[model samples]
Target: MTSLERVSISIEKRLLTRLEKLIKSSRYTNRSEFIRDMIRSKLVEQDWANERREVIGTITLIYDHHRRELSEKLTDIQHDHHDEVLASTHVHIAHDRCAEMIMVKGRVDRVRALADRLHREKGVLHAELSMSATGDSLR
Candidate 1:
């Protein structure tokens, strides 16, 4: 386990009250835990901002499967980024719709580019990329 440190911060009374309200609404037991998590979240985001940083994330896409050649196009795109894609799961949502969840591990820029390519394709209804770190620095 990493060493822990205790510190104190001073804030305006109203700011402290607002922070307490937020902490309660979020169901955090204490302000220290909430602040720690917030810092960790920001750190993860910063790690991904570096292009060379290796990261893991998921891409979720919803599209019309019945659209002309859309399924084939999507598969082709995935194949093009085979090195970065760890796994993918596809599900049929309706007669014409499908959803795919793609797990990817690669450099930040490469992963973001692949997701952007998939999201920009025709017939895609929605696409979302969830960013996360490999935890090399967060110990």
Candidate 2:
């Protein structure tokens, strides 16, 4: 097991009260766990901001499947970046619309590029990229 270190810091009374309110609403059991998670989230954000950092993310897309050549173009784009494309799944949102979630891992720039390309496609109704880290540094 890893050793634990207890540290202390001071904050203004008003900020502490606000922190308590956030902790209660988020349902965190203790201040230490909540603070640790907040720190980790900030670290993940830092990693994403570094374009050279290797990261993992999911590109989710909603589109009209019947649009001419749209599905083929999307598939071809993924194939072009096959090394970064980990896996993908497609499901029907309705008779005419489909959703795709593509898991990717690579340099931050490449992942962002893939998402951007997918997002700008003609038939795509919406596209969002959920950023994440590989967890090598978080622990």
Candidate 3:
């Protein structure tokens, strides 16, 4: 286990009150834990901002399966970036609708490009990229 250090900072009364409220709403036992998680979230954001950093994330897409050649096109795109796509799962949502989640890991730029390519496809109704860390720096 890592050693723990206690530090103190001064803040305005209003901000402290808001922090306490946030702590209660978030179901955290105390302020320190909450602040630590907030700091970790910021770190993950910073990691993604570094273009050369290797990050892991998922791309979720919902689309119409009936669209001509859409599935083939998406497959081709994934194949084109085979090194980055770790795995993918497809689900049939309705008679004509489908949903897919793709796990990807690579440099920030390549992953973003993959997500953008999927998002710009004609039949895709929705596309979302969930950015995450590779866990190398989180420790």
Q: What's the lDDT of the predicted structure labeled candidate 3?
A: 0.94
lDDT of 3 by residue, 1-139 (tens): 9998999999999999999999999999978889999988888999999989999999999999999999999999999999889999999999999999999999999999999999999999999999899988787
Candidate 2 stretches greater than 4 Å from native: none
What's the C-alpha lDDT at position 85 in model 3? 100
Q: Number of the top candidate by TM-score?
A: 2
In order of appearance, the predictions have TM-scores of 0.93, 0.94, 0.93
Error of 1 at 84 (Å): 0.9
CA lDDT of each prediction against the hidden true structure: 0.93, 0.95, 0.94
All candidates: CA RMSD in angstroms? 1.3, 1.1, 1.2
- Residue 68 of model 1, lDDT score: 95
Off by over 4 Å in 3: none
The digit string of per-residue lDDT tens for model 2 on 62-137 reads 9998999999999999999998999999999899999999999999999999999998999999999998899986
Clashing pairs in 2: none
